[model samples]
Target: MAFVKTSGYRGLHVFAPITPTREFLDVRHAVIGAARELARRMPTRVTTNWWKEERGERIFIDYNQANRDRTMAGAYSPRPLSHAPVSCPLEWSELAQTDPHAFTILTVPNRLRDQGDPWATMHEQPGSIDVLYSWWESDLADGLGELPFPPDFPKMPGEPPRVLPSRARRPD
Candidate 1:
């Protein structure tokens, strides 16, 4: 797994490369499975909640990022913030001590030359998502059903409504 800091953002991106043998939905299921397990193990510290209002102070694991055609900033991509912080890949050893603000657009190139890419071998071996599929099935059986999709995406069966929970009309 590669741990990265989205400089100027509130969360970390944890990535593990998977074999490209499945469709986007299948991959999403795998990610959701992993995220659910993390939330289960660390209920107070993590969340898979689709809405920020529900997420509270927990770190949100965005399994929805697996959705097809979705775009995301890549490693070293500079954020639009005034400080120009880059989406920096982190070395596990340094992750605890490093500050994201220090890896701005002006500093990353020299850091890269000195340290090399922390994710250089990320694709040296891709794993199958089939193992995670079992967890997804377990979650389904436990009634942890589909999460909400992006508002512009076509409606998916079993998805929670796209409206924010605060705005949704409560049943009388």
Candidate 2:
């Protein structure tokens, strides 16, 4: 299951499952597929800023974090950045008004005491990505294809050319 939380100021924070096989390509595909589904379900527009341009509006999926070396901050873990903020979980309704910076290592424990863990039942029932993978297949059949992978990784099967769209050769 994927849980998306608005970070109030930065952007959306997505929490998704990771399979033990650690296949980077599969992870990337699943995340993008889920993001597309999320955009369709959400009330707002979404876009991926791969080219660093204002490409209209869309739910931007930061897929670079899907790589083998990167990770989203775990719940209750303190981020190593300047303020030492913790990755806290909140009710979806609380997200809009909550200040992320206030959930530091110092305050998380007290919040947990007062309100209890929002994700306490997260593991009670596991979720499968079968639906998302099915969506990927459906999209492929509809001609919506692969997005670019990170430059450092090997060119994946079915991936478009690694060049930025602006630099790619136009077909005659």
Candidate 3:
């Protein structure tokens, strides 16, 4: 697991890679649980601009990034958005002092030349998601179930009805 602060915001972003599995929703649940747990341990905040409005502080796990079809920008790849910013990786300790704007396409190469890749040994050891899955089970025992999926995905097994909460009809 890795923690990063989003550029231009005081929000936390977590990146967790799990072994290949067909149980996508289960993975999503576990990841969310883990994010919540991490949030509880840290002094940071999480926010989501889901509906064009900032939903105030909460642990917002980006489970959609875990979807099979989705992909994130590579560590050194330049974003197509403004200023040609690059998605640079950083050491966990550097989080407090690092500025996102300083690591752009033109500056990353020199940075890399001066200091080798922070993620150089990232794949030397593998991690298991078993503990997270266990957390998933514990959350289930406490009555928590699946969270919402992207609107474009087909209705999945055990998924809650896809209606927006405001339009959802409550049980009679």
Give the best candidate by lDDT.
1
| lDDT agreement with native, every candidate | 0.84, 0.69, 0.64
Q: For model 2, how does the per-residue alpha-carbon lDDT over 57-142 read when each residue is reduced to its tens digit?
A: 65577767776776556677777767777778787778678888888778889999999987776665566566676777787788
Candidate 1: regions farther than 4 A off: 3-8
Which stretches of candidate 2 lie above 4 Å from their native place?
Answer: 1-9, 16-27, 40-44, 54-58, 64-69, 169-172
Of the candidates shown, which would achieve the greatest TM-score relative to the real structure? 1
What does each candidate score in C-alpha RMSD?
Answer: 1.5, 3.4, 3.7
Model 3 clash number: 0
Q: Distance (Å) between predicted and true CA of 145, model 3? A: 0.2
TM-score of 1: 0.92
What shift in Å separates residue 2 of candidate 3 from its native position after superposition? Answer: 3.7
How well is each residue in 7-81 modelled by candidate 3, as lDDT tens digits?
322333455444565376666766756655565576367532232233455556576666667766667777676
lDDT of 3: 0.64
Models ranked on TM-score: 1, 3, 2
lDDT score of model 2?
0.69
